[model samples]
Target: MLVAAAVCPCPPLLVPAVAAGAASELADARTACSDALAVLAASRPDRLVVIGPAEEGARGVHPAGAAGSFAGFGVDLTVRLGSGPGGERALPASLAVGAWLLDHTDWADAPIEGLGVGTELQPARCAEAGREIGASAERVALLVMGDGSACRTVKAPGYLDERAEGFDAAVGHALGTADPAALLALDPELAQALQAAGRAPWQVLAGAAEGTGLEGRLLYEDAPYGVGYFVAAWS
Candidate 1:
């Protein structure tokens, strides 16, 4: 069962080096993420699983010490999920961001692992995957990484979509309240249309938290660079 969970955006921009001169733009998000991670540490979980959306080839399990690089984003930084023997396979971008966050927090409370879910993964499969994770350890903690709508403005990666704001709002509310049913109820097709990458990962979190009685607090919600980024903590 999940002892705690932290939800955060997966944008590479969260890394100061990746963001370069604009790093300050995400200062609040970074602080919120820090606080969320603190919550995870406080739970004293036996295991930590980092879940994030990924491309087809990147989907699957990433072991502790799995390597991730920001070099692709023009940064020389490299991160590991946690200290252990490294893996041959590279982590997906989303998991890489998750790894970066873990490194930033110097997380040492539990053994860490990562799962990269495809953006198009069905809700059922996502939930099933989450259930498996929840059962993997006596006290599990999750660091979920993915972005909300990417079309809040014309400058957004997917460009402006009229439905973006409403979609993000609903997601924010659901996360803030730790409403698994509401998260599971998100329309996949609509989410895809709005370019909401968080849909699948958030649903996975919902599945893992079932019967855990966790309550959530929304730490941050914003549309920066036209993409919705959120940070929430459940405990």
Candidate 2:
């Protein structure tokens, strides 16, 4: 069962190296993420599983030391999922960002592992995967990585969508309240249309937290660079 959880966005912009001039814009989000992780560590879970979005065929376990680099995004920064020796497989962007967060925070809470869930993954499958993770260890915690809608403004990456604001608001409510029903009820089709990368992973979180009675707290919420980013903690 899940003893704690930290939710954060997966944008490469979270990395100072990748964001460069725009890095300061996300300073608050970074702080919130750090605070959330601190709560997770305080829970003293025996295991941590990082869940994030990936390509359709990229769904699988990313063991400790899985390689991650921002070279594709024009940066030389590299990170590993854990302290293990490097692996040949390069993590997908979302997991890469998750790894970067761990490296940036110098996480030593618990042994860490990663799982990539496809963007269009069915809710049932995502829940099943989550159940497995929740059962994998005695006191499991999650570091869920993925971004909210990217259509918050006309200048957003996906451009303006009239429904974007409402979509993000509902998501924010679900997360801030730790409403598993609301999370599981999120419409996949609508999420895909709005370019919400967090849909699948968020559902996984819902599955893990179901019946666990973990209270949630919203630490930060913003749409910097036109992409909805959030940081929250549950324990």
Candidate 3:
């Protein structure tokens, strides 16, 4: 069962080196992420699983100590999921960002692993994956990483979409309230249309927390660089 969970945005920009001169723009979100990690530490979980959206090549399990680098983003920084045996597969960008967050927070409370869900994965599969993760240990914690709508502004990655605001609002509410049903109810078609990368992973979180009865708090919510970023903690 899930003892605690933290929802965070997966933008590489969250890393100061990746963001370069623009790093300060995400200072508040970074602080909130640190606080959320503290909540996970307090839970004293037996295992920690990081979930994030990934491309086809990066989808699937990434073991603890799996290596990932920001070189693809023009940075030479490298990160590991946690201290453990290394794996052959590299961490996806989303999971890499998750790893970066773990490192930044100095997480050492439990064994760490990662799962990279494909963006096109169906809700049912995502939920099943989550259920498996929740059952993997006695007390499980999750660090979910993904972004909301990228169509908040005309200059956004997906360009302006009239439905973006409403979509993000509902997502914020669901995450803030720990409403699994609400998260599961999100329209995949609509989410894809709005380029909401968080849809699949958030649904996975919903599945994992099905009967955990965790309470939630919204740590932060914002649209920076035309992308919706959110941080929430459940424990």
Candidate 4:
């Protein structure tokens, strides 16, 4: 069962070094993420699992001490998932972003693990993975990282799509209310069409929280850089 869960966007821009001049624009997002992590700590969970969308066929389980670096994004900054047995396995971008969040929050109470789910994964499989995660440890907590839609504005990465706004709205509502059914019911086809990276991982969250009755609060929602980023907490 999930004792607590924090949902965050996995943008490289979340890191000040990576964002550079644009860093100030995401100040509120940073604060919201910090507050969400604080909420996770308050739950006193013994373990935390970080889930994020990854490349096609790149389903990897990263250990707590797995390293992550932003050099590929033009930054040399590096972060660790937690304190597992140190290894050379570098985390994928999504898991790297999640690792960066854990490091930034100075998480220490529990060991942290990361799961990278392929973006195109079927909802059923994603949910099953989530169920496994929730059952991995007693008093487990989760940090789900993925972006909403990337086609909100005309300048958006995927270009403006008329359906983007409505899609993001429903996602926002579902996440804010901790509606598992809504999340589970999210259409993968529509999400892919809208370039919503959060679909699969959010389904994983839905699986973990099914029947848990967790109350949710939307911490933040914005479209900085034309991509929908959201932060929420379920407890």
In every candidate, how many clashes are there?
0, 0, 0, 2
> For candidate 1, what is the TM-score?
0.98
Q: Which segments of model 2 are wrong by more than 4 Å?
A: none
lDDT of model 4 at position 70 = 94
**Model 1 lDDT, residue 171, Cα:** 97
List, residue by residue over 28-75, the lDDT tens digit for candidate 4: 998999989888888889889888988754467887788888999999
Backbone clashes in model 4, listed as residue pairs: 64-82, 65-84
**Per-model C-alpha lDDT, please?**
0.92, 0.88, 0.92, 0.88
List ranges where model 1 is wrong by over 4 Å: none
Q: What tens-digit string does per-residue lDDT give for candidate 3 at 1-235?
A: 9989999999999999999999999999999999998888888889999999998878888888999999999999999998889699899999999898888785666999998887778888888888888998999999999899999999999999999999999999999999988998889999989989999999999999999899999999999989999999999
The candidate 4 region of ten consecutive residues with least summed lDDT is 55-64
lDDT per residue, candidate 2, 136-227, as tens digits? 88999999998999999999999999888898999899999998889989899999999999999999999898889999999999998678
CA error at residue 82 for candidate 1, angstroms = 0.3
Superposing all C-alpha atoms, what RMSD in Å does each candidate have to the true structure?
Answer: 0.9, 1.2, 0.9, 1.2
For model 4, state the Cα shift of residue 202 in Å.
Answer: 0.5
- Mind giving the per-residue lDDT tens digits that candidate 1 earns over 1-235? 8999999999999999999999999999999999999999888999999999988777888888999999999999898999888678899999999988888885665899999888888999888888888998899999999899999999999999999999999999999999988999999999999889999999999999988889999999999999999999999
lDDT of 3 at 80: 97
Per-model TM-score, in order, reads 0.98, 0.96, 0.98, 0.96
